[model samples]
Target: MDVSVFEVIGPIMIGPSSSHTAGAAKLARIAKDIVNASFNRVTFGLHGSFAMTYKGHGTDRALVAGVLGLYEDDEAIADSFELAKQQGLEYEFYEINLENVHENTVKITFLLEDGSNYYVIGSSIGGGQIIITNMNGFQTEFTAQYSTIMMKHYDRYGIVSEVSAILANSHINIATMRLNRNARGEEAFCIIDTDDIVPYDVKECIEQLDGVIQVQVINVND
Candidate 1:
C-alpha cells in the first residue's frame, strides 16, 4: 500500500499525543476549510477515546483551535475557548455512538452564518494520521495529503469524460478518483486527488463544465 507525505512526515503540532491532539486539530481545520465561511455554531460529537480522554489529552482545545483556523503548533490553542467566546462562536460537545469507527473518531457539524450546515466524520488513525470518512451525509473518503477536488454534479453521461479531458488538457495528473451516488439520474459526488497542484484555472474550467453544480478544492498545504 502507498502512503502520503503527511503520513510519513506527521502533522506539525505541539503535542504529547498525535492521534488525540494533532489529528483532532486537522479534522477541524479541514472541516472549516470545506465550509468556507465563519461559523455561527458548532457541535463536536466525540466518540470512544475522544469522549473519554479528550479533555485530559487536550483534544477538546485542539478541535476548537482548528475551528478557529489555528494550526497544530499555535500556542494560542490553550486559550481557544475564551477566544471563541470573544468571537461569538457558540460550541458544544456531545458523546455519541458512531458504529464501526476508530476509537479516535469525531463527528463535527458546522452551522455557518449563511444558515448552511456541513457534517464531517473523521478519525485519527494514530501516528498523526487522519482520514475523513463522510461529508455532508455522503459516504466518501478524504485524506488531505495531495491537492483534492470534490464536486457535486447531476448524475449524467459525459460529465466524467469531460472533466477528465479538461484535466488532461491542463496536464493535471489524477492520483486517484472515486464517484459515489444514490442512484441513476440523481446528485453525484466525485473526489479527485491529484499529483500536482490544481490551479485556479483548472477549477474554473471544471466549474464551467455542464452538469457541475458545486466544486471544492483542498490544497495540499491546507
Candidate 2:
C-alpha cells in the first residue's frame, strides 16, 4: 500500500519533530494499552535523536503524559510531569543504545500497580507514524493503524487455527498476522491486525482457548 499524503504530512500534534515528540507519546500510549493496568512506575530509554533532543522537543513530557492516558495532540502534555506526580505515577528517563534501530527510538519498561510489568521497543519513523519493533524480547513490527490482538500462548500446534477460526467466525478480516517465539514449542507471541474491531467477547473466547496464556486487544483510536 502506498503511504497516504496525510500520513507523510503528519497529524495534529504539539511537536518540534513528529518523530521525537508525537511518536514518543504514541509509543507510550501503546505500552499503556499493553500493560492495561494502573500505573506504578515507568522508565524510558531514549536512543539517538530521542536521547539528544528529548528535553528541548518535549519528548520526555510527551511520553509521561501518554502513560497517564493523554493523546499526542493533547495540550496537557507540557505539564506531564506535574500530572504524573498528581496521579502518583513515578517515572524516569535515560539514554540508551539500541543497536541497528532508527535514530528516533525508545525502549520503555512499565511497572503496574497490580505488580505486572511490560517492556516494549518503538521507533518514530517521522510524520507521527511509529512502529513497535519488540515486545517482551520478541522481535516484531507493527504500526498501530488497525485494531490489533496480541496473544501469548504455548508454541504448540492448533493455537493459530483456533484463534483464526474464532476471528473468521466473528466476521473479522485479518489484515496481517505475525508470530514469534522464544524457542520451538515454548512461549510464543502472536500479533493479529484486523480490518475491523474485534469485540471484547471475542477476546474472551480466545483467552479461554487451552494454550492461550493472555490476550490484549488494542483498538486503533487514531
Candidate 3:
C-alpha cells in the first residue's frame, strides 16, 4: 500500500489533537457544503472520546468554526464561539453514546432558515483524516478533501450513466463513485468524486436530469 504525504507527515492544522480539531473541522465544513445553504442554528452530538475531551481539547470551538466555513488552520478557530455569536449562528453541544462507531464520531445537525434541517454523521480517524459515515439518513463514506457531487434520484437504470455522461461533458474526470438505495426501485443516492472542480452550472444541469431529485456539488478543495 502506498501512503500519501499527508498521512505520513500529518496535516497543516490548528489545535492539538488532529482527530478533535482538523478532522472535526473538515467533517463539519463538508456537511455545511453538502446542504449548500445557510443555517441559523446548529447542534453537535458528540459521541465516545469526543464527549470526554471536547471542551478541554478545543473540539467545540473547532466544530463551530467549521460550520462557519473557517479553515482547519485558521487562527479564527480559537475564537469561533465569539464569531458565531456575532454572526447570529447559534450552536449547542451534548454528549451521547452510540454503538459500533469510532470513538471520535460526531453528529452535526443544521436547522436551516426555512425550517428545514439535515444531519451529517462522521468520525475523526486520526492524522487529520475523516470519513463522513452518513448523510441525512443515508449510509455513506466520503472524504471532503476533494471535489465531489452527491445526488438523490429515483432508483432506475441509466441514472448513474446519465450522471457520468454529464460529468464527462463538463470536462470533469470521475475518480470514484458510490451508490446506495433505500430499496429496489426506490429512492437512491450517488456520490461521485471528480478529478476537477465541479462547476455550479454542472450541478444545475444534473438537477434537471430526469429522475434526479436533488443535487449537491461540494468543492472543498477550493
Candidate 4:
C-alpha cells in the first residue's frame, strides 16, 4: 500500500510542531483575516501542553503575534505581547481543559473595535499543520496548504452552487470544504479545499464575485 503525497508530506509550514507552533500561528493569522474590526483585545484559552510549556516553546507569543497577522518565522514573536500593547492590542490569557480534545489546542476570542467580536477554535496537528475546528459559532476546518482557497462572505443566494460551477468548468476537484459565520450571521467564511493549486487567474475570477470581499492564497511555503 502507498500513502498519498499529502498524507506523507502533509503541509509545508514554519514549525516547532505542526500542532503546537505553526498551526497555532496559522489559526491566529486566519482569525485576524476574518475579523472586520481592528483587534483591540484578545483572549486565549490554552490547554494541555500549550498551558504547560507554551512560553518555553514560544507557543504563547507565537499565537498572539499570529493573530496580529505576523507569520511564524517573524523574529518579533517572543515579544509579540508587548508589541501588541504598543500597537494598541490588549490581550488576556486563560488556561482551560478542552475535555478530551487534542492536547495542543486553543480557543481564541477577540474583541474588535466597533463593538464586534469573533472566536475561533483550532488545533495544531503536528509538523506545522493546523485545522480550524470552529469560527465564530460555525464549525469549520481549513488546511492552509491550498495554492488557492476561496473564502466567500455569506450571501442568501446560491453562492456555493455558483462557485462550484466555476471550479467544475476549470476541472478542479473539491478536496475539502468548511463553512462558518459570525454570531450575528451577517457574514460567513466558506473555505474551499481543492486538489489543484489555485491559479492566479482563477483567484482573480473569484474576487470578482458579487459578494466576495477578498480572495487570498495562503502561501503555505512562506
The most accurate candidate by TM-score is 2
C-alpha lDDT (0 to 100) for residue 44 of candidate 3: 97
Taken over the whole model, the C-alpha lDDT of each candidate is: 0.89, 0.90, 0.90, 0.73
**TM agreement with the true structure for every prediction:** 0.94, 0.95, 0.94, 0.73
Report the C-alpha lDDT of model 4 over 25-124, residue by residue, as the tens digit: 8778876765535768899999888988887777887898898888776767667889888888888778988775678888898887778877878878
Tens-place lDDT per residue, model 3, 1-222, is 988887777899997878899888877887888878878999999999999999888999999999999888999999999999999999999998878889999999999999999998999998898899899989888987678899999999998998899888989999998999999999999999898999988999899999999998878667
Q: Over all chains combined, what TM-score does candidate 2 have?
A: 0.95
lDDT (tens digit, per residue) of candidate 2 on 1-222: 898885768878988778788888988888788777676899999999899999999999999987888988999999999999998888999999989999999999998677877788999888888999998788888899899999999999899999999999999999999999999999999999999998999999999999999999998954
Model 2's alpha-carbon lDDT is 0.90
Error of 1 at 24 (Å): 0.4
TM-score-wise, the better of 2 and 4 is 2
Q: What is the lDDT of residue 173 in candidate 2?
A: 99
> Which window of 10 residues has the lowest lDDT sum in candidate 4?
6-15
Question: In candidate 2, which residue ranges exceed 4 Å CA deviation?
Answer: 1-3, 114-116
Winner of 2 and 4 under lDDT: 2
Off by over 4 Å in 1: 1-10
